[model samples]
Target: MKAKKIERKVSIALLFSITLLCCGGGQSLLAQANPAVFQIFEKYSKQKKVTLLEVSEELMAEYRIKQFKSIIFEDGTLALPEIRRCIEQDKQDAKKLKEATADGLVVSGYYRLKTVDPAMNRYLIFKVGKKNKVTLLYIEGRLTPEELVELLK
Candidate 1:
């Protein structure tokens, strides 16, 4: 039970962090549409703004799977395998993810400059989905790995 609670906190924290950076732009209703992502993140862990290290198209797919796992775990009803089954069923969604990564997803991920006075660098990453959605908002300085991963959660 304690473990579950910890997991849930982490998810929330990550969601909150993403919201801070991603949604502040002129009414990006995209977040509203992706509520499942927020809810899942909210339910599984704490919001954190980690320094983005790097990102890849391949990583985006794994990231999607990880988010789904976190959500499934919180539900207590669906197993990882079940979640995988659901992903497999979404052929269209999978295709979109793949296509997105191919186009806009930066290989080493985009860099986000965070902090001041000896600024810290964070890498923000994105995945293309037959379109470019990487710059969802005006990221401050350079995007770090964590910032790049903002869209994923």
Candidate 2:
């Protein structure tokens, strides 16, 4: 009976360790999977409400790109009608390069804004999550669409 108790206790401990390893490991892997995304958020961490307009040239000229604009929810939710419209427009005009979904969150691929001028071809990426959380990143300049897609992947 003592031997059986020891074996059961060891089994329980092993199961607990595995559970923690799986849960913690997945988050680290996800964070590392796209360090650039995290970096972008960290760069703007001071902003109380980071809207697409806040990053505009009229506001923060340092991060401005004339051809690109972003729309983010202050509450991290994307339930706004304007945001929905913009996303739909992007879906219609931009070419999707890659996307991934886990749990209730979705990270879509970099899209080259086709509706814009060819010389100003901007890249857009979006992260949509549960509870109306959404983040949009707009990038412009010499970065090729392929490079942007790779960064997003």
Task: Using lDDT, give the best candidate's number.
Answer: 2
lDDT of each: 0.32, 0.55
Give the TM-score of each candidate: 0.20, 0.43
TM-score of 1: 0.20
| Candidate 2 lDDT trough over 10 residues, lowest sum | 30-39
Per-candidate alpha-carbon RMSD to the true structure: 18.3, 18.2
